[model samples]
Target: MLPKSYFDIFLVILLVPILNLFVYLHNSFSTSLSYLGLPYFIEPDITVDADHVSSSSSPATRRCNIPLSALLLRELLPVVKFSNLVDPPNSCSVCFKDFETEDEIWRLTNCRHIFHRSCLNCWMGYDQKTCPLCRLSLVPHDKEEMYNERLWRLCNNCQL
Candidate 1:
């Protein structure tokens, strides 16, 4: 038989790579299982009516529109001295530009964060309906509620 030291060295040489490979495989499997356990969002099913045949067979969900009122644009947004700002003093959060007296300042209703009127308008028009700073929904909760709110605002503004 081989010497005791020689046997130990041979065993160490043979087992080290095997142990490393086993550890690597175990870690890889654990990572894969962890990913698999994560929750995923699923879209609702679309159904078509047999009687009323339509050209496009797509799900019809009401789309929400941006509610831009004169009150919100003009009166709700008040210009203040740059020095008078409470937090994030003297700058628009959206544009990261210094607030000059001539610049139009608009504060978000939910988060109370201030931004430039032109910058916030552009952002709300194109990018998102949520607040840039707080991610709060600028519109009403549902499409129907948003529609009703818009109509109410319009009627009240028009004195109808």
Candidate 2:
């Protein structure tokens, strides 16, 4: 049988290439991994708790009523007069319309202002509650229609 010293040397020899290969692979992978935007060496799937129900997952029957209050000032009042001349016929402020087409008439929600839905959605996503044009306050005061008029008053105050 081989001596203990020989076995020790044999083990060291066997491990050296494996250890070197591991170091090389680690270095190679680490450099590539840095290019990807990640905080750590590993990431796990995000999980939500059972107590929290997703808004999208909420059952239609369980929620019987619409959040009427969530409607913006524009939806609350349809009779209010709005001006398309503030920006331009095709030039919408929401998307910064370049007046490209006649069909591109921007609809101002009941808020007496105008914007492309794309731009407005982007703006609203940031939680702005006023019309971009008339500056009407869009928050719901109650279930009544006064919310639109109240917003208009707020807009008037803002203009002054």
lDDT of each: 0.55, 0.47
lDDT tens digits by residue: candidate 1, 1-160: 9999999999999999999999898777767755885211122222222222222323223212333332233333355544555664567777788888666566655567778777777775563667788898554343436444654644444331
In candidate 1, how many Å is residue 31 off?
61
Candidate 2: worst 10 consecutive residues by lDDT? Answer: 59-68
Residue 131, model 2, lDDT:
68
Q: RMSD for each model, in Å, please?
A: 16.1, 14.9
In candidate 1, position 43 carries an lDDT of 22
Give stretches of model 1 more than 4 Å off. Answer: 1-88, 139-148, 151-160
Top candidate on lDDT is 1
lDDT of 2: 0.47
